[model samples]
Target chain A: MDDAPAYSPTPRTRATRNRDRVRYDAATVHAILDEGRLCHLGFVADGAPVVLPTLYARVGGVLYLHGSTGAAAMRAARDGGLEVCATVTLTDGLVLARSGMHHSVNYRSVVVRGTARRVSDEAEQRSALDAIVDAVVPGRSADCRPADAKELAQTAVLRLELREVSAKVRTGGVNEEPEDLDLPHWAGVVPVTETIGAPEPDAAMAPGTPLPGYLRTFTGASD
Target chain B: MDDAPAYSPTPRTRATRNRDRVRYDAATVHAILDEGRLCHLGFVADGAPVVLPTLYARVGGVLYLHGSTGAAAMRAARDGGLEVCATVTLTDGLVLARSGMHHSVNYRSVVVRGTARRVSDEAEQRSALDAIVDAVVPGRSADCRPADAKELAQTAVLRLELREVSAKVRTGGVNEEPEDLDLPHWAGVVPVTETIGAPEPDAAMAPGTPLPGYLRTFTGASD
Candidate 1:
C-alpha cells in the first residue's frame, strides 16, 4: 500500500509471452481496475470453469464484487472463500496490419487470481456498495437512496484482495512487414473510444428536475 | 445448427435466478457474439482458473479463438481438447436506479462452455484466420495480405463448438421500488457507445496513401 510499489510476480502471474508489455507496478493495476465499470469473474463450478460479467470496485487492495444473493457464484463464495480469476479490459484502438496474421487490438488488461470471500462485515458491506456505485459514476452513491435493511439482506457482496495480479498492455500503431509496406494496403490505427450520450431523464421526474452535477461531468472513458 | 432453434439448457446452463433475463435462442446468442471483437476465455491451468482476453470470431456454430502459439491456454487446447468457457459481453447502457440495490448495467452477453481443440484442418484454419480479421472490421480479410506458411505455423487457433451456450441480457429503464419512485434521484439509462475516431496512418507509410474504402465507412458499433 505504499504510494506505488510493484507487486512481486507469482509464478502464475508472470508473463510467458510479450514479456515487455507485462507490468507489475500497483499504479498500472489500480488505474485499469478503476477505469472499468465491469469485470469478468471466472471460477470453478461443478469442476468446470464458469465466466460471468459483474460490477466491481476497488477500495485499497481489495476488489468488491456485486451480485444477487441467489447467484451461484455468490453462494459458493459465501460458504467459504471461492477461488476466482477476475479480469478487466479497456480497448484503446484497432491495430491494423498489412498482413492478416499481424492484426491485433490495442488494449490494457489486468488479471487477478485469488480467493474472494463474502463481505460479512455489515459496515464494510455498506461501504463496498457505495464504492461500487461511485466506481461507475463518482459521487453517485450519495445522490441515490441507500439500500434499506431488506434490500441489503438480498444483496451479496464479495471482496477479492489484489494479492496475485499482473497487467498486459498493447499500444502504438500498425505493425507490418518491411516488404509489405508498399503492398497497396492502407495500414493505420483506428482509435476506438467509449462515449456516453445525452442522458434520458426518468419521465416521472419533475419537468424542471436538473441534471446532477456528477451526471453533467460524467465520461465513459478515463483520462 | 437450425437458424432459430433454442438451445436446450443443461443443469449447468439453466438460470438459477432472474430467469426472465436468460435466453437460449440461437439468434440472441449469435447477435451478441458477433457484436463483440474480443472475448474472455476461462480455462483451468495448473489446477486453478485463468482468464484472458483474446480476439474471437464465429463461423457457423463454432467460435474461432486467435492467440499466439506460445500462450498457455493455446498450448493446453492444442495438446488435447481443453475444457474452456468463452464469454463475450457488449455494454449497451448504464442503468442508474433510485436505490443502490437496484443499480445494474444494460448489457448483452453470451457464454459458451465446451471443450475447445486446436483447429488442425488446413482449409478451416485459413478461413478461420480470415474470419477473425473480418470480425473486427467486415471485409478486412480481403484487403490485407493473407498469412503465409511461416505466419500460419506460428499462429495457434482454437475452435469451440456452440453446443452448451446461453445468453443473458439486461435492457431498458431503471428498476426501482414503487415507494422510491419519488426519491429525487436521476434514474434512467445513460447511452453508451463505442465510436471510432479518424484513422492515424503509420508514420512509415507514404504521405499520400489513401484511406481504404472500408476504412472510410468503418464504425465501431455494429448496426
Candidate 2:
C-alpha cells in the first residue's frame, strides 16, 4: 500500500453538516468515485451555476472527462484550465426515521474541486479514453476498436487532478430521538441497489458472436 | 388535463449539444424528477461552483429541498433567494460502439435553473417535510411519525419554482460509423438498472413489526 498522506480538503469540499461523516483519506474518496458511473459536473457559465451529468473515470490521482469538441462546456474547458466541481454520489438506502426531520438516505459521495485542462497528448488521451471504457465495463477496451485519428480529433478529453477532495458517507440504520422510540410507526432501512441487467445484442451482430465473459459476469458497485 | 403550456427553457437550461434531446414539456420534466431519489444541486459560493447531493421533492410546479438549519448552503439559500441549478440523472446502459468516440451511456436527465427561497410558513413547511420523506419511499410519510415543532424549526427548506426546466433523453442502440460495422469486435448495450433489496429490520425494532407494502414492492425508474 502506498503510504501517501490524505488529501487536504479546501473550504469548498469540506462538509458543513454532519461533520463527522467527512473523510479526507484517499482510499475512501477513490472508492466512492470508482463505484459511481455518473457524475454531476458543476461549472459557472455566464456568471450562473450550471450542472450537467457526464461520464467520467479516474486514473491514479487524476480524473478524466470527455465530450464532443463542439460542446460549449467542453470548449470552455479545452480553451484553458476551467475551474469546476465534480461530484459522484451513490445512495445505498432510504433511512426511515421515527420522525420526518431525521429521515435521510444512506449514501457515499465524493466531491472534488479543481481545474480541468484539455489533454493534448495523443497517447495519453487514447489511454484515458480506454480507461473510461474499462471503468464502465472492465476488460471492454480489448474487445473494441480504437478511435481513428479523425474521431480522436473530434473528441475532447479534460483532465482534473484530485488534489482537493472529500468523501462524506452515511450508512446503517436510522437515527431516531430517544423520546420517539415508542412511536407506533415501523422504522428501518429500505436498501437501494444498482444491478446490471442482461446484455442486449445489436440487430446487425454476427449470428454466433458469443457474449464475452466480462459482460456475462457483470456486477455493479460491488465489483 | 390542465392544458397549460410547457416550460420555456431559458438560456441556462437549454442543451448546448444534441439540441434534439431537450424537452420543454412539464410532464416529462416532472416524471424524471419524481422518479429520481436524489439530485445534484449546483449553486455558486464565493464565485465558485459547488455541487452536492440532496433529497428533493416536487409539488405542482415547485421543488422543495431541505437540510440542517446550520448547513452553509442551506443558510445561504434561506438568507436570500439564491440562484441554483438542480440536475437529476438516471443512467440506463453502457452503449458499446464499434469506435471509441461513439460509445455513450443511455440516460434520461433533467436540469432545472431557478432561484430558491426559504419556506417559512408553518403549514407549508410541515407538508414539504412530509413530501420529502415520501419522495424517498412513496407512502412513507403516512406510515412514519410526523415532524414535531422543534424538529421543524431546526430544519431549513428551500423552494425552487420549475419555470425553467428541460429533460434530455438518449435511448436505443449505439450510433456507429457505417465503415466500422464490419469490425471484428463485439458491440452492443449492457443494460443497467436500479432496484431495492430485501429490507433489513433495525436492531431495536419491535419483534413483530412487519415490512410495509411499499418497502417490499419497491421498484426503480423503469417501473
lDDT of 1: 0.87
Can you write out model 1's per-residue Cα lDDT over A1-223, one digit (the tens) per residue?
A: 6365978899998888889989989999999999998898889887889888889999988899886524667778989888999999999999889989879889999999999999988899999999999998889999999888887887889999898999999999887788988887878888999989887777877887778888888943222
What TM-score does candidate 2 get on C-alpha atoms? Answer: 0.94
lDDT comparing candidate 2 with the true structure: 0.82
Per-residue accuracy of model 2 over A1-223 as CA lDDT, tens digit each: 2244689877666666789989999888888988887789998877888888877899989999865423666767878777788999998988888787778889999988988888999998999999888888888888788888987897788899989888999998989888889887778887888878777788788987877777766743122
Q: Candidate 2, clashing residue pairs?
A: none
Candidate 1 regions off by >4 Å? Answer: A68-70, A219-223, B69-71, B219-223
Interface RMSD for each predicted structure: 1.2, 1.5
Candidate 2 segments whose C-alpha is farther than 4 A from its true place: A1-3, A68-70, A219-223, B1-5, B68-70, B219-223
lDDT, candidate 1, B34-150, per-residue tens:
999999988898778888897999988989998652466777788878899998999988888988888888899999999999988878999999999999988899999998988
Model 2: which docking level applies? medium
Q: Tens digits of per-residue lDDT for model 2 on B1-223?
A: 1244588877666566788877888778888988997889898887888888878998888899875423666777778778888899998889988777788899999888888888989999989988988888888888877877877888888898888888999899988889889987778888888878666677788997876777666643222
TM-score of chain A of 2: 0.93
Complex DockQ, candidate 2: 0.74
State in Å the error of residue A123, model 2: 1.6
